[model samples]
Target chain A: MKFGIMVNEGPYTHQASDSAYNFVAAALEKGHEIYRIFFYHDGVNNGTRLTTPPQDDRNIVNRWSALAEKHEIDLVICVAAAQRRGIADADESKRNGKDADNIAPGFRISGLGQLLEASIQADRMVVFGD
Target chain B: MEEAGETKKIMYVNRKAPYGTIYALEALEVVLIGAAFEQDVYMMFLDDGVFQLKKEQDTKALGVKNFSPTYRALEMYDVEKIYVEKESMEVRGLTADDLIIPVEVKSNEEVTKMMTEMDVLLNF
Candidate 1:
Protein backbone atom coordinates (compact mmCIF):
# COMPACT_ATOMS: atom_id res chain seq x y z
CA MET A 1 0.00 0.00 0.00
CA LYS A 2 1.01 3.61 -0.56
CA PHE A 3 1.10 6.07 2.31
CA GLY A 4 1.52 9.80 2.86
CA ILE A 5 3.23 10.73 6.11
CA MET A 6 3.80 14.11 7.76
CA VAL A 7 6.36 14.66 10.50
CA ASN A 8 6.01 17.94 12.39
CA GLU A 9 8.38 17.49 15.30
CA GLY A 10 12.07 18.08 14.99
CA PRO A 11 14.32 15.17 15.89
CA TYR A 12 15.82 17.02 18.85
CA THR A 13 12.55 18.30 20.26
CA HIS A 14 10.67 15.01 20.39
CA GLN A 15 10.79 11.37 19.33
CA ALA A 16 7.87 11.83 16.95
CA SER A 17 10.15 12.55 14.00
CA ASP A 18 12.33 9.55 14.73
CA SER A 19 9.25 7.40 15.26
CA ALA A 20 7.77 8.51 11.98
CA TYR A 21 11.03 7.75 10.21
CA ASN A 22 11.26 4.32 11.76
CA PHE A 23 7.65 3.59 10.95
CA VAL A 24 8.13 4.49 7.33
CA ALA A 25 11.41 2.59 7.15
CA ALA A 26 9.87 -0.50 8.66
CA ALA A 27 6.90 -0.24 6.33
CA LEU A 28 9.30 -0.02 3.42
CA GLU A 29 11.19 -3.06 4.64
CA LYS A 30 7.84 -4.81 4.61
CA GLY A 31 7.36 -3.72 0.98
CA HIS A 32 5.33 -0.55 1.37
CA GLU A 33 5.71 2.49 -0.81
CA ILE A 34 5.78 5.97 0.74
CA TYR A 35 3.77 8.15 -1.59
CA ARG A 36 5.25 11.27 -0.03
CA ILE A 37 6.75 12.57 3.21
CA PHE A 38 6.17 16.15 4.35
CA PHE A 39 8.26 18.11 6.85
CA TYR A 40 6.53 21.04 8.45
CA HIS A 41 7.11 23.69 11.18
CA ASP A 42 10.10 22.61 13.22
CA GLY A 43 9.93 19.44 11.20
CA VAL A 44 11.06 21.65 8.36
CA ASN A 45 14.44 21.63 10.03
CA ASN A 46 14.62 18.02 8.88
CA GLY A 47 15.54 19.34 5.43
CA THR A 48 18.39 21.59 6.48
CA ARG A 49 21.72 20.65 4.96
CA LEU A 50 23.32 22.63 7.73
CA THR A 51 22.22 20.41 10.62
CA THR A 52 25.11 19.00 12.67
CA PRO A 53 24.03 16.42 15.18
CA PRO A 54 26.51 14.56 17.37
CA GLN A 55 28.39 11.80 15.57
CA ASP A 56 27.51 9.31 18.33
CA ASP A 57 23.82 9.84 17.61
CA ARG A 58 21.91 8.74 14.55
CA ASN A 59 22.16 11.33 11.81
CA ILE A 60 18.43 11.85 11.44
CA VAL A 61 18.84 14.01 8.37
CA ASN A 62 21.13 11.48 6.74
CA ARG A 63 18.77 8.68 7.66
CA TRP A 64 15.84 10.46 6.12
CA SER A 65 17.77 11.52 3.06
CA ALA A 66 19.15 8.04 2.51
CA LEU A 67 15.77 6.43 2.91
CA ALA A 68 14.16 8.68 0.35
CA GLU A 69 17.12 8.30 -1.95
CA LYS A 70 17.15 4.52 -1.68
CA HIS A 71 13.43 4.19 -2.31
CA GLU A 72 13.25 7.12 -4.72
CA ILE A 73 10.51 8.54 -2.57
CA ASP A 74 9.07 12.00 -2.77
CA LEU A 75 10.47 14.04 0.14
CA VAL A 76 8.74 17.36 0.46
CA ILE A 77 9.45 20.31 2.76
CA CYS A 78 6.73 22.89 3.29
CA VAL A 79 8.33 25.96 1.72
CA ALA A 80 6.40 28.27 3.98
CA ALA A 81 7.40 26.37 7.07
CA ALA A 82 10.96 25.85 6.00
CA GLN A 83 11.61 29.42 4.96
CA ARG A 84 10.14 30.71 8.18
CA ARG A 85 12.70 28.52 9.89
CA GLY A 86 15.53 29.49 7.52
CA ILE A 87 15.41 26.60 5.06
CA ALA A 88 15.40 27.84 1.49
CA ASP A 89 16.13 26.14 -1.83
CA ALA A 90 18.37 27.65 -4.46
CA ASP A 91 15.44 28.81 -6.52
CA GLU A 92 13.79 30.48 -3.58
CA SER A 93 16.98 32.10 -2.37
CA LYS A 94 17.67 33.47 -5.80
CA ARG A 95 14.11 34.60 -6.39
CA ASN A 96 14.04 36.45 -3.13
CA GLY A 97 17.55 37.78 -3.64
CA LYS A 98 18.59 35.99 -0.50
CA ASP A 99 22.25 35.13 -0.10
CA ALA A 100 22.07 31.56 1.09
CA ASP A 101 20.41 28.23 0.29
CA ASN A 102 19.58 25.71 2.98
CA ILE A 103 17.65 22.93 1.24
CA ALA A 104 18.72 19.36 1.99
CA PRO A 105 19.09 16.73 -0.71
CA GLY A 106 16.29 14.27 -1.43
CA PHE A 107 13.89 17.00 -0.44
CA ARG A 108 11.95 19.44 -2.59
CA ILE A 109 10.85 22.76 -1.15
CA SER A 110 7.18 23.12 -1.94
CA GLY A 111 3.84 24.51 -0.85
CA LEU A 112 0.63 23.05 0.61
CA GLY A 113 -0.63 22.31 -2.90
CA GLN A 114 1.70 19.34 -2.99
CA LEU A 115 0.12 18.19 0.25
CA LEU A 116 -3.34 18.58 -1.22
CA GLU A 117 -2.34 16.64 -4.29
CA ALA A 118 -0.78 13.89 -2.19
CA SER A 119 -4.02 13.46 -0.26
CA ILE A 120 -5.90 13.05 -3.51
CA GLN A 121 -3.41 10.51 -4.84
CA ALA A 122 -2.45 8.45 -1.81
CA ASP A 123 -4.62 5.95 0.04
CA ARG A 124 -3.86 7.24 3.53
CA MET A 125 -2.32 10.35 4.99
CA VAL A 126 -0.89 9.85 8.47
CA VAL A 127 0.18 12.79 10.58
CA PHE A 128 2.89 12.59 13.24
CA GLY A 129 2.96 15.70 15.37
CA ASP A 130 3.49 17.20 18.83
CA MET B 1 -14.70 20.79 -14.60
CA GLU B 2 -16.27 20.11 -11.23
CA GLU B 3 -15.95 16.88 -9.30
CA ALA B 4 -19.73 16.37 -9.22
CA GLY B 5 -18.70 13.62 -6.82
CA GLU B 6 -18.10 13.47 -3.11
CA THR B 7 -14.52 13.35 -1.89
CA LYS B 8 -13.15 13.35 1.60
CA LYS B 9 -11.86 16.71 2.82
CA ILE B 10 -9.74 17.41 5.91
CA MET B 11 -9.18 20.77 7.56
CA TYR B 12 -6.38 21.18 10.08
CA VAL B 13 -6.72 24.17 12.39
CA ASN B 14 -3.46 25.62 13.77
CA ARG B 15 -4.31 27.95 16.65
CA LYS B 16 -1.18 28.02 18.70
CA ALA B 17 0.87 31.11 19.41
CA PRO B 18 4.30 30.27 17.93
CA TYR B 19 7.58 30.58 19.86
CA GLY B 20 8.16 28.49 22.97
CA THR B 21 6.17 25.85 21.00
CA ILE B 22 6.02 23.74 17.83
CA TYR B 23 2.35 23.03 17.14
CA ALA B 24 2.17 25.22 14.04
CA LEU B 25 4.79 23.11 12.34
CA GLU B 26 3.10 19.91 13.44
CA ALA B 27 -0.29 21.00 12.15
CA LEU B 28 1.25 22.04 8.85
CA GLU B 29 2.80 18.62 8.36
CA VAL B 30 -0.62 17.03 8.61
CA VAL B 31 -1.88 19.44 6.00
CA LEU B 32 0.87 18.47 3.61
CA ILE B 33 0.82 14.71 4.14
CA GLY B 34 -2.95 14.71 3.65
CA ALA B 35 -2.50 16.65 0.45
CA ALA B 36 0.16 14.22 -0.71
CA PHE B 37 -2.40 11.45 -0.60
CA GLU B 38 -4.50 13.55 -2.97
CA GLN B 39 -7.07 14.30 -0.30
CA ASP B 40 -8.68 17.70 -0.16
CA VAL B 41 -6.75 19.56 2.60
CA TYR B 42 -7.48 22.95 4.11
CA MET B 43 -5.80 24.97 6.91
CA MET B 44 -6.87 27.84 9.18
CA PHE B 45 -4.92 30.18 11.48
CA LEU B 46 -6.81 31.57 14.45
CA ASP B 47 -6.00 33.09 17.86
CA ASP B 48 -2.28 33.17 18.44
CA GLY B 49 -1.88 31.37 15.18
CA VAL B 50 -2.24 34.81 13.69
CA PHE B 51 1.44 35.23 14.50
CA GLN B 52 2.23 32.29 12.26
CA LEU B 53 1.43 34.52 9.30
CA LYS B 54 3.29 37.57 10.50
CA LYS B 55 6.14 38.86 8.37
CA GLU B 56 9.63 40.06 9.38
CA GLN B 57 10.17 37.04 11.59
CA ASP B 58 13.92 37.08 11.95
CA THR B 59 14.33 34.64 14.79
CA LYS B 60 18.08 34.57 14.25
CA ALA B 61 18.33 37.50 16.63
CA LEU B 62 16.62 35.32 19.18
CA GLY B 63 18.98 32.43 18.32
CA VAL B 64 16.53 31.16 15.65
CA LYS B 65 15.92 32.17 12.07
CA ASN B 66 12.26 32.99 12.02
CA PHE B 67 10.06 29.97 11.23
CA SER B 68 7.40 32.06 9.51
CA PRO B 69 9.42 32.15 6.29
CA THR B 70 8.34 28.69 5.14
CA TYR B 71 4.66 29.55 4.75
CA ARG B 72 5.50 31.56 1.66
CA ALA B 73 6.65 28.42 -0.12
CA LEU B 74 3.35 26.59 0.36
CA GLU B 75 2.03 27.75 -2.96
CA MET B 76 4.15 25.29 -4.90
CA TYR B 77 2.72 22.38 -2.94
CA ASP B 78 -0.78 23.46 -3.95
CA VAL B 79 -1.70 24.11 -0.30
CA GLU B 80 -3.03 27.48 -1.27
CA LYS B 81 -6.15 27.44 0.87
CA ILE B 82 -4.52 29.23 3.84
CA TYR B 83 -6.67 31.30 6.19
CA VAL B 84 -6.38 33.93 8.94
CA GLU B 85 -9.15 35.23 11.17
CA LYS B 86 -9.69 38.99 11.22
CA GLU B 87 -10.35 39.07 14.91
CA SER B 88 -7.18 37.19 15.64
CA MET B 89 -5.14 39.58 13.54
CA GLU B 90 -6.78 42.57 15.17
CA VAL B 91 -6.10 41.24 18.62
CA ARG B 92 -2.50 40.87 17.61
CA GLY B 93 -2.39 44.27 15.95
CA LEU B 94 -1.64 42.77 12.54
CA THR B 95 -2.94 43.71 9.13
CA ALA B 96 -2.93 41.67 5.95
CA ASP B 97 -0.13 43.86 4.66
CA ASP B 98 1.99 43.02 7.69
CA LEU B 99 2.10 39.34 6.88
CA ILE B 100 5.14 38.23 4.88
CA ILE B 101 3.13 36.02 2.56
CA PRO B 102 0.00 36.64 0.51
CA VAL B 103 -3.05 34.68 1.70
CA GLU B 104 -6.79 34.95 1.43
CA VAL B 105 -7.51 36.89 4.60
CA LYS B 106 -11.10 36.65 5.84
CA SER B 107 -13.48 37.43 8.70
CA ASN B 108 -14.97 35.04 11.25
CA GLU B 109 -18.02 34.50 9.05
CA GLU B 110 -15.84 33.54 6.11
CA VAL B 111 -13.83 31.25 8.32
CA THR B 112 -16.98 29.55 9.58
CA LYS B 113 -18.13 29.04 6.01
CA MET B 114 -14.95 27.17 5.24
CA MET B 115 -15.12 25.16 8.44
CA THR B 116 -18.75 24.16 7.90
CA GLU B 117 -17.82 23.04 4.38
CA MET B 118 -15.16 20.60 5.53
CA ASP B 119 -15.88 16.87 5.73
CA VAL B 120 -13.41 16.37 8.55
CA LEU B 121 -11.84 18.80 11.00
CA LEU B 122 -8.71 18.38 13.05
CA ASN B 123 -7.33 21.03 15.43
CA PHE B 124 -3.94 21.31 17.11
Candidate 2:
Protein backbone atom coordinates (compact mmCIF):
# COMPACT_ATOMS: atom_id res chain seq x y z
CA MET A 1 0.00 0.00 0.00
CA LYS A 2 1.10 3.55 -0.67
CA PHE A 3 1.18 5.61 2.53
CA GLY A 4 1.33 9.36 2.91
CA ILE A 5 2.77 10.73 6.15
CA MET A 6 2.07 14.16 7.58
CA VAL A 7 4.25 15.42 10.44
CA ASN A 8 2.96 18.45 12.33
CA GLU A 9 5.53 18.96 15.09
CA GLY A 10 9.27 19.54 15.27
CA PRO A 11 11.86 17.13 16.66
CA TYR A 12 12.85 16.91 20.37
CA THR A 13 9.96 19.18 21.40
CA HIS A 14 7.38 16.51 20.51
CA GLN A 15 7.35 12.81 19.81
CA ALA A 16 5.54 13.46 16.52
CA SER A 17 8.74 13.46 14.48
CA ASP A 18 10.06 10.27 16.08
CA SER A 19 6.74 8.46 15.73
CA ALA A 20 6.47 9.48 12.07
CA TYR A 21 10.06 8.34 11.45
CA ASN A 22 9.47 4.97 13.07
CA PHE A 23 6.16 4.57 11.25
CA VAL A 24 7.80 5.30 7.91
CA ALA A 25 10.68 2.95 8.63
CA ALA A 26 8.26 0.21 9.60
CA ALA A 27 6.16 0.83 6.53
CA LEU A 28 9.27 0.59 4.37
CA GLU A 29 10.35 -2.59 6.12
CA LYS A 30 6.94 -4.06 5.39
CA GLY A 31 7.63 -3.34 1.68
CA HIS A 32 5.13 -0.49 1.33
CA GLU A 33 5.87 2.49 -0.87
CA ILE A 34 5.83 5.91 0.74
CA TYR A 35 3.94 8.33 -1.46
CA ARG A 36 5.44 11.35 0.32
CA ILE A 37 6.09 12.88 3.70
CA PHE A 38 4.51 16.32 4.01
CA PHE A 39 6.00 18.49 6.74
CA TYR A 40 3.80 21.30 7.94
CA HIS A 41 3.66 23.73 10.91
CA ASP A 42 6.54 23.03 13.30
CA GLY A 43 7.20 19.86 11.37
CA VAL A 44 9.08 21.97 8.83
CA ASN A 45 11.82 22.30 11.40
CA ASN A 46 12.83 18.75 10.57
CA GLY A 47 14.17 19.94 7.22
CA THR A 48 16.73 22.42 8.51
CA ARG A 49 20.38 21.53 7.86
CA LEU A 50 21.64 23.90 10.57
CA THR A 51 20.70 21.78 13.56
CA THR A 52 23.87 20.91 15.48
CA PRO A 53 23.13 18.40 18.17
CA PRO A 54 25.77 16.79 20.42
CA GLN A 55 27.86 14.02 18.81
CA ASP A 56 26.19 11.48 21.11
CA ASP A 57 22.69 12.69 20.24
CA ARG A 58 20.71 11.31 17.32
CA ASN A 59 20.50 13.79 14.44
CA ILE A 60 16.83 13.86 13.55
CA VAL A 61 17.25 15.95 10.39
CA ASN A 62 20.04 13.74 9.04
CA ARG A 63 18.04 10.63 9.87
CA TRP A 64 15.13 11.82 7.71
CA SER A 65 17.48 12.86 4.92
CA ALA A 66 19.20 9.49 4.97
CA LEU A 67 15.94 7.60 4.90
CA ALA A 68 14.66 9.64 1.97
CA GLU A 69 17.88 9.11 0.12
CA LYS A 70 17.77 5.35 0.64
CA HIS A 71 14.10 4.88 -0.27
CA GLU A 72 13.95 7.61 -2.94
CA ILE A 73 10.89 9.09 -1.18
CA ASP A 74 9.72 12.62 -1.70
CA LEU A 75 10.14 14.58 1.52
CA VAL A 76 8.10 17.75 1.13
CA ILE A 77 7.99 20.71 3.45
CA CYS A 78 5.11 23.17 3.11
CA VAL A 79 6.36 26.46 1.68
CA ALA A 80 3.99 28.57 3.75
CA ALA A 81 4.88 26.79 6.96
CA ALA A 82 8.59 26.62 6.11
CA GLN A 83 8.66 30.33 5.36
CA ARG A 84 7.00 31.10 8.66
CA ARG A 85 9.57 28.96 10.44
CA GLY A 86 12.58 30.06 8.32
CA ILE A 87 13.17 26.72 6.58
CA ALA A 88 14.08 27.51 2.99
CA ASP A 89 15.73 25.85 0.03
CA ALA A 90 18.22 27.31 -2.40
CA ASP A 91 15.53 28.33 -4.84
CA GLU A 92 13.40 29.85 -2.09
CA SER A 93 16.39 31.73 -0.67
CA LYS A 94 17.21 33.12 -4.11
CA ARG A 95 13.56 34.04 -4.70
CA ASN A 96 13.23 35.70 -1.33
CA GLY A 97 16.67 37.35 -1.56
CA LYS A 98 17.94 35.68 1.58
CA ASP A 99 21.63 35.23 2.42
CA ALA A 100 21.50 31.51 3.04
CA ASP A 101 19.36 28.40 2.52
CA ASN A 102 19.00 26.00 5.43
CA ILE A 103 16.88 23.24 3.84
CA ALA A 104 18.39 19.83 4.53
CA PRO A 105 19.19 17.34 1.76
CA GLY A 106 16.48 15.08 0.26
CA PHE A 107 13.71 17.54 1.22
CA ARG A 108 11.98 19.91 -1.16
CA ILE A 109 9.94 22.96 -0.26
CA SER A 110 6.57 23.03 -1.98
CA GLY A 111 3.02 24.29 -1.57
CA LEU A 112 0.17 22.72 0.39
CA GLY A 113 -1.18 21.44 -2.92
CA GLN A 114 1.42 18.65 -2.76
CA LEU A 115 -0.17 17.55 0.51
CA LEU A 116 -3.64 17.54 -1.08
CA GLU A 117 -2.29 15.58 -4.03
CA ALA A 118 -0.71 13.04 -1.70
CA SER A 119 -4.02 12.58 0.12
CA ILE A 120 -5.80 11.92 -3.17
CA GLN A 121 -3.18 9.58 -4.60
CA ALA A 122 -2.10 7.64 -1.52
CA ASP A 123 -4.25 4.81 -0.18
CA ARG A 124 -3.95 6.26 3.30
CA MET A 125 -2.81 9.59 4.75
CA VAL A 126 -1.50 9.32 8.33
CA VAL A 127 -1.07 12.50 10.37
CA PHE A 128 1.16 12.63 13.49
CA GLY A 129 1.07 15.60 15.83
CA ASP A 130 0.10 16.91 19.22
CA MET B 1 -20.10 19.80 -9.46
CA GLU B 2 -17.61 17.40 -11.07
CA GLU B 3 -15.47 14.90 -9.21
CA ALA B 4 -11.77 15.51 -9.71
CA GLY B 5 -10.58 11.91 -9.29
CA GLU B 6 -11.19 8.68 -7.43
CA THR B 7 -13.18 9.58 -4.29
CA LYS B 8 -11.85 8.69 -0.84
CA LYS B 9 -13.52 8.97 2.55
CA ILE B 10 -11.59 11.70 4.40
CA MET B 11 -12.35 12.83 7.95
CA TYR B 12 -11.01 15.93 9.70
CA VAL B 13 -11.18 15.48 13.48
CA ASN B 14 -11.13 18.77 15.35
CA ARG B 15 -10.10 18.22 18.97
CA LYS B 16 -9.05 21.74 19.82
CA ALA B 17 -10.65 25.16 20.03
CA PRO B 18 -10.05 28.14 17.76
CA TYR B 19 -7.89 31.27 18.43
CA GLY B 20 -5.77 29.68 21.17
CA THR B 21 -3.74 27.93 18.48
CA ILE B 22 -3.41 27.82 14.69
CA TYR B 23 -4.56 24.21 14.35
CA ALA B 24 -8.22 25.11 13.98
CA LEU B 25 -7.58 27.64 11.19
CA GLU B 26 -5.00 25.52 9.40
CA ALA B 27 -7.26 22.48 9.55
CA LEU B 28 -10.05 24.58 8.01
CA GLU B 29 -7.63 25.58 5.25
CA VAL B 30 -7.02 21.91 4.45
CA VAL B 31 -10.80 21.35 4.31
CA LEU B 32 -11.10 24.19 1.81
CA ILE B 33 -8.40 22.58 -0.30
CA GLY B 34 -10.12 19.22 -0.04
CA ALA B 35 -13.16 20.93 -1.49
CA ALA B 36 -11.36 21.16 -4.83
CA PHE B 37 -10.39 17.50 -4.66
CA GLU B 38 -14.07 16.43 -4.54
CA GLN B 39 -13.56 13.69 -1.94
CA ASP B 40 -16.12 12.35 0.53
CA VAL B 41 -14.95 14.70 3.27
CA TYR B 42 -16.36 14.85 6.79
CA MET B 43 -15.63 17.20 9.71
CA MET B 44 -16.12 16.00 13.31
CA PHE B 45 -16.28 18.40 16.25
CA LEU B 46 -15.62 16.83 19.65
CA ASP B 47 -13.97 17.96 22.90
CA ASP B 48 -12.77 21.54 22.57
CA GLY B 49 -13.19 21.13 18.84
CA VAL B 50 -16.92 21.70 19.38
CA PHE B 51 -16.02 25.28 20.21
CA GLN B 52 -14.85 25.84 16.66
CA LEU B 53 -18.42 25.64 15.38
CA LYS B 54 -19.91 27.82 18.07
CA LYS B 55 -21.99 30.82 17.01
CA GLU B 56 -21.19 34.51 17.53
CA GLN B 57 -17.40 34.13 17.87
CA ASP B 58 -15.93 37.55 18.53
CA THR B 59 -12.16 37.86 17.92
CA LYS B 60 -11.97 41.63 17.94
CA ALA B 61 -11.11 41.84 21.60
CA LEU B 62 -8.43 39.20 21.05
CA GLY B 63 -7.16 41.18 18.04
CA VAL B 64 -7.43 38.24 15.67
CA LYS B 65 -9.48 37.63 12.56
CA ASN B 66 -12.77 35.92 13.28
CA PHE B 67 -12.88 32.69 11.25
CA SER B 68 -16.37 31.61 12.23
CA PRO B 69 -17.88 32.86 8.96
CA THR B 70 -15.63 30.52 6.97
CA TYR B 71 -17.51 27.52 8.37
CA ARG B 72 -20.63 28.80 6.62
CA ALA B 73 -18.75 28.71 3.30
CA LEU B 74 -18.04 24.99 3.64
CA GLU B 75 -21.50 24.30 2.29
CA MET B 76 -20.63 26.04 -0.95
CA TYR B 77 -17.51 23.90 -1.22
CA ASP B 78 -19.68 20.76 -1.10
CA VAL B 79 -18.36 19.86 2.38
CA GLU B 80 -21.75 19.25 3.93
CA LYS B 81 -21.08 16.29 6.23
CA ILE B 82 -20.33 18.24 9.42
CA TYR B 83 -20.83 16.19 12.59
CA VAL B 84 -20.86 17.47 16.16
CA GLU B 85 -20.58 14.97 19.03
CA LYS B 86 -23.84 15.05 21.04
CA GLU B 87 -22.25 14.40 24.41
CA SER B 88 -19.51 16.90 23.76
CA MET B 89 -22.09 19.55 22.93
CA GLU B 90 -24.17 18.84 26.06
CA VAL B 91 -21.05 18.87 28.21
CA ARG B 92 -20.00 22.20 26.79
CA GLY B 93 -23.54 23.58 27.10
CA LEU B 94 -23.70 24.00 23.31
CA THR B 95 -26.60 22.84 21.18
CA ALA B 96 -26.97 22.53 17.44
CA ASP B 97 -28.61 25.95 17.46
CA ASP B 98 -25.54 27.43 19.11
CA LEU B 99 -23.37 26.56 16.12
CA ILE B 100 -22.90 28.80 13.11
CA ILE B 101 -23.81 26.05 10.66
CA PRO B 102 -26.30 23.20 10.77
CA VAL B 103 -24.71 19.86 11.62
CA GLU B 104 -25.74 16.30 12.28
CA VAL B 105 -25.50 15.61 16.02
CA LYS B 106 -23.93 12.21 16.64
CA SER B 107 -22.97 10.17 19.67
CA ASN B 108 -19.33 9.20 20.30
CA GLU B 109 -20.06 5.60 19.36
CA GLU B 110 -21.55 6.65 16.06
CA VAL B 111 -18.64 8.96 15.40
CA THR B 112 -16.12 6.23 16.22
CA LYS B 113 -17.88 3.88 13.84
CA MET B 114 -17.76 6.52 11.14
CA MET B 115 -14.03 7.02 11.82
CA THR B 116 -13.36 3.33 11.33
CA GLU B 117 -14.77 3.58 7.81
CA MET B 118 -12.64 6.50 6.67
CA ASP B 119 -9.76 6.12 4.21
CA VAL B 120 -8.00 9.09 5.73
CA LEU B 121 -8.19 10.56 9.25
CA LEU B 122 -6.72 14.02 9.96
CA ASN B 123 -6.73 15.27 13.53
CA PHE B 124 -6.14 18.85 14.71
Per-residue CA lDDT of candidate 2, range B1-98, in tens? 33446888889999899988888988898788768777889999999999999999999889999999999999999999999999999999999999
lDDT of 1 by residue, A72-106 (tens): 98999988777677888999999888999987789
Quick one: best lDDT, which candidate?
A: 2
Q: What local lDDT does model 2 show for residue B42? A: 93
Per-prediction DockQ scores?
Answer: 0.15, 0.52
| Residue A101 error, candidate 1, Å | 1.1
Could you tell me how far off, in angstroms, the CA of residue B111 lies in candidate 2 after the best superposition? 0.5
Q: Give the per-residue lDDT of model 1 (tens digit) for B2-88.
A: 232446777778888766676766565555455545446677888998888877776765675466767876777777777788888
Global Cα RMSD, each model: 8.3, 1.9
Residue B59 lDDT, candidate 1, scale 0-100: 73
Badly placed stretches (over 4 Å) of model 1 are B1-6, B13-123
